[model samples]
Target: MCHMTACSLLSYIAIAWLKMVPMQTIRSRVQFMKISTLSLIFCASVVSGNVSLKYLPVSFNQAIGATTPFFTAVFAYLMTQKREAWLTYVTLIPVVTGVVIASGGEPSFHLFGFIMCVAATAARALKSVLQGILLSSEGEKLNSMNLLLYMAPIAVVFLLPATLIMEENVVGITMALAREDTRIVWLLLFNSSLAYFVNLTNFLVTKHTSALTLQVLGNAKGAVAVVISILIFRNPVSVTGMLGYSLTVIGVILYSEAKKRSR
Candidate 1:
């Protein structure tokens, strides 16, 4: 939580320094309450994702994450009444089925972790949908940088209290860790700086394409993560699990093609 809060604060500072947005004009352009609500959803997504990694192996966690497009499609329809081509809908079947298969084959399956990952994925999908719906109007619309400018500070405010309440003496713990190894502090700072660009690109992608499309892209990212994590962690993998993951990736590829043809 501390790391995440730091990332939010860092992003806020960077955006302000870059002068990407006019600080005084934000109020005239959009309602603070609306942006604040979206920031809450952003906090939930970040927290749930971080928590799930504690209980689940990266490979398994990312395998489940491959189903994000399925959730995104559902949320996009519910929030925006947007419909995709029938072929696009059909491609989701394998995307969903593969995850079910992978879950059955997973060696270190934690029910609680699974639930958390699902929540994280759903919250992420919801964030994208709500951002589009809430900010689509001409008057309310914000470019990716401006959206991050507003959201970062609001997310920091939302996270600080929760971090303090949930993680006892977080500052003390971090200080102790930093004293033990100065390298940890540098690593954290590097990670937080990277998060700014990640959030910027995420907002940019969602702005340009549909939310469901972003999830389809994320499926490919998860596939890459699966391979990289297995190599780094030496995590055991089963043939069934590999088969299921393969199916999921294939499904995502088909989904992208279907969407392109529809366009």
Candidate 2:
């Protein structure tokens, strides 16, 4: 929580120093409301996602997350009534089916965890779609850094109370741990720096592409993370799971090609 807060503060400061837009010019109640809404969704997704991790294996959590594209497509259709190529819809089928197959093979699964994961995934998709819609309007368009500068502080506000309630001893624990291991401090600083970049890039991506495209990329990212984990951690993997993940990757590739050709 502290890391996130620091990163958000740094991002806001960096943007101000760059003079992209005066902080005063960015003030609007409507804009605040929009950013606050996104902050709430972002907070819910992160909290639920982390909570789900306690009850589900990391692999299962990721497998469930890989269904983000499906929800993205559904929400995009419902919200905008936009239609995609038949091939785009066809490619989404395998993307979902593969995740289902992989999740079915998980040795550990809990109903609560499954529900939370689903909620998190849906919220994430909604965030992306809503961000795209919000930024698509000529009146609402703001540069990515400016958007993050505003949104990050709102997120910090939303997260602060929750951190206090849920992690009451976090400060004490961190202080104690940091005394023994200065590496903890360095790691946190590194993490905070990366978090800023993550937020910046996320806004940039949503600005450049539709939410469905971002979700498709997210699905591919999950597959890549799984492969990295298997390689770096020597994690055990079943043949069925491997095959399912392979199918998802292929689907992502096909979906990318279809989207490019459509464009």
lDDT of each: 0.79, 0.75
Q: How high is each candidate's TM-score?
A: 0.88, 0.85
Q: What is candidate 1's lDDT per residue for 130-227, written digit by digit as tens?
A: 77766675667766666666777778788888889999999999999999999989998888877776776676687778755775677678889999
Q: Report clash pairs, candidate 1.
A: none
- Predicted candidate 2 versus true structure: per-residue lDDT over 59-139, tens digit per residue: 667777777767878899999998888887888888788777766655565789989998999999898788778777667
RMSD of each: 2.8, 3.0
RMSD of 1: 2.8
* Top model number, TM-score: 1
Worst ten-residue run, lDDT, model 1? 21-30
